[model samples]
Target chain A: MDMYTCDSMPSSRSEGSARSKLLSLAGMSKSYSPTVCALNGLDLSIEPGEFITVVGPSGCGKSTLFNIVAGLEEPDAGSEIRFLNKPVNKASELLGQVSFMPQRDLLLPWRTVIDNAILAIELEGKRRADARRIALDMLPEFGLAGFENQYPNQLSGGMRQRVALMRTFLFGRDLMLLDEPFGALDALTRTMMQRWLLDVWQKHRRTIMFITHDVEEALFLGDRVLVMTARPGRIKLELPVTLDRPREPDIVTSPEFIRLKRELLIAIEEESRKSFAPTPSAGH
Target chain B: MNVARDLLKHLCEALLRGALTVLTMAVVWELVVRVGGVPSYYLPSLVDVLAAVTVAPGAYVDSALRTIAETVLGFAGGAVFGVLIGVAFFQWKALRDYLFPMFVISQTIPVIAFGAVVVLWFGNTLWAKAVIAFYMTFFPVTVNTLQGLNAVDPRQVALLRSFGANAWQLLTRLRLPAALPQIFVALKLGATLSLLGAIAGEWFGDSVGVGVLLLHAMYNEQIPALWAAIFLAGAIGTLLYAVMSYIETRFVFWRDEL
Candidate 1:
């Protein structure tokens, strides 16, 4: 089994490397109420043009982390979040800096495909005609060539996700946070989407932080896979995947892929069991 | 050709059903009045009511047009005000908390009871009838608009916020569009209520309108004229409702599927 320490990896700020630091979280903690702590003392750094997949037990603050990074919520005090080496003082400041996709493909049912794709640009005050023109041009690239005028309900689950992905990409942000984007798809469709996503990622070369509960998905897609603890989640393990890319679906059956998947399963299983364990303490 | 044929079939079915119902009712009424030996002044036969309508078609038509004008005017005014207030309430929690219960209370006061006050305030003008109609029409719209606005999916709101959408941008683009189906529901209810309000207002002393004709027929002891006036009012209300329903189907075409 191959393992790499995060510190040993070349920093984005280091000379002679094409990669550059895009995001860094230091001692990041988030609490929803007085009784609920979602994330605690988490620290991580991301370089540009890397795919990082995160996996954890249910209710382990996976979504909370995404929310904080997306600028929908602020981290607790004594925490620091830096984007492109610049510290952000407020959660709202992170707006428009990163694109985010929730687990459900939240496409507006009222809007047609082309209109939905241009939602972000339209929000930025661009003219509707210009946004439509640009979205029309990118439809074929998103596998949505002839479906521009169709509403969200008219499309299949996979096609809806493709439309959402196109919307996220069209936002043109440097960092993207996608939370289980294909988790709702069937097994066959999920595999197909993963390969298609990789192809798109390779072409775009944007920094991506993907959240998932599936171990095989983590191993298959990420350059680095992070496993988090049961609750008040923080990174418990970070394993760099050594699989060479332009990866095909057949790679999941390979011995090296299986080995990595097994290791990640064990790490995630330990945390999952902790979450399901009965709490011994009485109500305070 | 096929689409046209299908539409024609639907139209025929609807007309056939309506004709059957009317014919049954007419026969039942005619038999009951004749067998009971009821006087024509107390309760007119269906034939007598039809004769009344034919006798003074011009008078009935003029009154119908005036009432339609008041209903349409008041409905339009109420819709505009209701949407504006609903949006304001959504933007300010304090305003909604302080004022929403008041709106509910105002609705409880019967439109007929409020019609007296409307006539006292506006006096014999078309505005008097319109004021009552407006009063009846706005509250449902305000309540439904609020419900629809509140019903927007939180995830969709977050998605827009992530894209740096400000409050106005969120409302115009997402919140307003999402609330449309519910707003249309209230609008349909308002359409019927506005017509009722207009007719009730006319009873407070109007020179023209179906309500005025009904009062004239009642005082003069013209049973067939009274029935004819009632029929015209019912017809207009149904027409308004049908038109509103059609508009709703066109605008909110996604409702059934979504």
Candidate 2:
């Protein structure tokens, strides 16, 4: 375990500087229709190379926020989203700036593991042979060494997620948005994947924004955990984990870990209760 | 060596099963004709038809080849155009809304009724038969292509779009490959329909095809010759379908794994 004072912490971003912020969202809001708001006036600042985990109730606009970040959907007017200090006007302008992994592995069934891993590189108009060579080298690191030629269906669920993670890593974007990537996995596999993911993240040090419903997962993986409110979601609480790393699987059972989990549980439980409460006027 | 043996065993089993079916059908047909005291003109025995084919194998082979050429040409043209139009329709919703109904209406017009008009336009050349075949083949291909394209997982599209995939790249890399299994279904249907169209087109006074031979045998009351022509046509249809199935297996290999 390694510990450092806040002032002496080693970060890609300079300590307490605006320039350290890789992404900042001020009054960031989205609505599918005129009357229905999915996200509302959410403000968040993410430091470079930080692992930020967000947990919220179901239908709490978590996906909407990811969509906006991924350039799949636009935020409503007056919402501000900045990437690397530049303001993004349209949702599409954010394209290729971040690597996004949706909940499902979403691997192309036709493509082999290596081919799927190199899809982002190929899309950027790079040479297939070069991309394939790079993907081949990275396969062993991602635990997919021998299964390069196998289709997505041939691999187990955990292996498929690993392939998806490998694909995101190969994209080599500074910012990565993962939407409940290991939510589908069983308890044992999820725990193993968590430790494996931290090991990879420590080595790569790419800024990651992970969304998960599991409170333990959020606390275990994140340097900072953000709890979001119910529908038309807004950040309700931001708790910084001061625990030392490299964190082991056993650290999840520590007293400090339990304390943090209890605090998050309270915040999340309050928001989840609000989610079930009837709105003033709901429309289909 | 073990894999090879298994493959050989599978092939032998398939062939033996097919042979048994043919033998049983032949015996039943011979029994029905002889026992029922059916006239030769009304219904020929399997042996009579085989003898008729052997008598003038050249004529039967030549006619079969010509019809096959027409069917193949028309099917190729239809498949290419259908896929292109399907892609166009998928890219533009307004275009699909306007043209897809017209395609539906076009299919409703009987092949016989449209074959006469096709002959008038294309004349008695090979093009005339090909035109009818194209007409029959294109509809299923277009319908299935659109269905397949529309059926693509939306999440997959979003994932690619996040990677900054342009329209052409998305189509080539994702949409096209995803649509293959469904597209192959239409192609298999189109194969049989194309053969039927080519034979029907020959009814409009074409001189050299299986359709012409069938018309001649029918009018002259040459029952064995008619059955031989029918058999030749059936064989061609079966062959085309088998070829398409082989292609489907090759291209849509992921379907079996799924």
Candidate 3:
């Protein structure tokens, strides 16, 4: 772990910035109602090519953060957002700037595998045939070569997620926000997908900020893990993982990995207990 | 080879079942009249109705064709216009708010009441009858089109929007296709209303259509002739409904999942 504080992370505004930051957020807050605040005073910075994982209790505004970044919803007026070192004024300005994947794969039921992958490209007014050609070349690497003509229902759970991932990757954005992309998979499939995702990430080298409830997943996949507090969420801990790349499945059993997992679990459990503290929020 | 044989078997079974159902209905109709000893003035025999149609087959055929033509013209016009208006309503809330109550009021005014005005406007041509049919058909289509468009999953809309889809792109690629099943529901109802509208429109001084023949039979107490016209009209309606259903199944292949 670097000796850097996540609060005033001297990465984005540093004078000796050898390389520029990919994304930075300060005072990022969202409130659905006057009484209900979802996110409060979020500050973070992401460097290019970093795989950042976030863990928080349920209703911790993880998805709200993602929506703001994906340009689906606006943050409060005073919040600061900078992408590629340029200040982002409104969420609309960030539209189509980041590739976003929600919890579900959300493949169009009507579109075929190939058509679904090229949807973003086709939406940009590119010819369907040309967009199709681009998707065809990248199919094999995503392990979906023979399944071009097949529909979403024809594919298995893992295959469906791959198709969604393929769609996100093909959008050609510098940053990707993945909200529990593999949360629906079975355990064995989830393990296989996590490793395959790292392989894909390494090859593409795009900045990724992923959200998950699983502490092990956070430790195994993320370069740095951000643990968040309960309702009215704010970062409680930012634990940097020093694990080397090309990490095998066996590395998950290493002592260092276990130590990091224990620390994260403690931080997350504390917040989880606070949320369960006897209050009207629980029954609702 | 096995798949082809299975398909053949399924088609044969469907045909056999449909034939059995018709046979049962025919038997019940014939028995109800003969055993109950109903007067010919009240209920004509099944064979009498068929024989009546066969007796003046040429006239019956011409009337049937004319009525069908009017219905088709009206149905086509109503279908195209309803969807266009439905899309307009969906895209512009202000237009929907302004004109939707007018549409409801228009629907409330009975088509039979509208038929007289339609005849006055268009004269005794097929255009008069078709106008009534168009009137009867468009409201349901408009209501349903708006409903179907609104029923689109917002998540799916969001997914497309995040991909940089503009409004037109959203409608054509995602909204329209997704709303097809609901739109087809409106279309099926419109088919029936158009046929009803056509027959009703024929009541206003048309001398050569099925509605005119029915009026002639009723006034002159030609019970078999009335029954014959009624049966022919029923057959036409059934045929149109089946066509609509077949088209719906063909287009809405993903409806099962939705």
Pick by TM-score: 1 or 2, better one:
2
Q: Write the per-residue lDDT of candidate 3 for residues A119-226, one digit (tens) a residue.
A: 888887789999999999999989999999998988999999999999999998999999999999999999999999999999999899999999999989999999
> Which is superior by DockQ, 1 or 2?
1
**What is the clash count of model 3?**
0
TM-score of each: 0.92, 0.92, 0.92
Per-residue alpha-carbon lDDT of model 1 for A52-156, expressed as tens digits?
999999988899999999999998876778898788898779987799999998898889999999999889889999999999999998899999999999999
- Can you list the residue pairs that collide in candidate 2? none
Q: Residue B21 of model 3: what lDDT?
A: 91
Q: Which ranking of candidates, highest DockQ first?
A: 1, 2, 3
lDDT of 2 by residue, A81-191 (tens): 888988888878988879999999999989999999999989998899999999999998899999999999999999999999999999999899999999999999999
What TM-score should be assigned to candidate 1?
Answer: 0.92
DockQ of 2: 0.73
Candidate 2 Cα outliers beyond 4 Å, as residue runs: A1-19, A279-284, B1-16, B256-258
Task: Please give, for residues B100-209, the per-residue lDDT of candidate 2 as tens digits.
Answer: 99999888989898877888898999999998899899988888888898898999999999999999998999998899888999999999999999999999978899
Fnat for model 2 comes to 0.70
- Point out the worst 10-residue segment of candidate 3 chain B by lDDT: B3-12
Correct interface contacts retained, every candidate: 0.72, 0.70, 0.51
Report how closely model 1 matches the true complex, as a DockQ value: 0.73
Please say which candidate is ahead in DockQ: 2 or 3: 2
Q: To one decimal, what is the Cα RMSD in angstroms of model 1 from the true structure?
A: 5.2
**Model 1 segments beyond 4 Å from truth?**
A1-19, A280-284, B1-20, B31-43
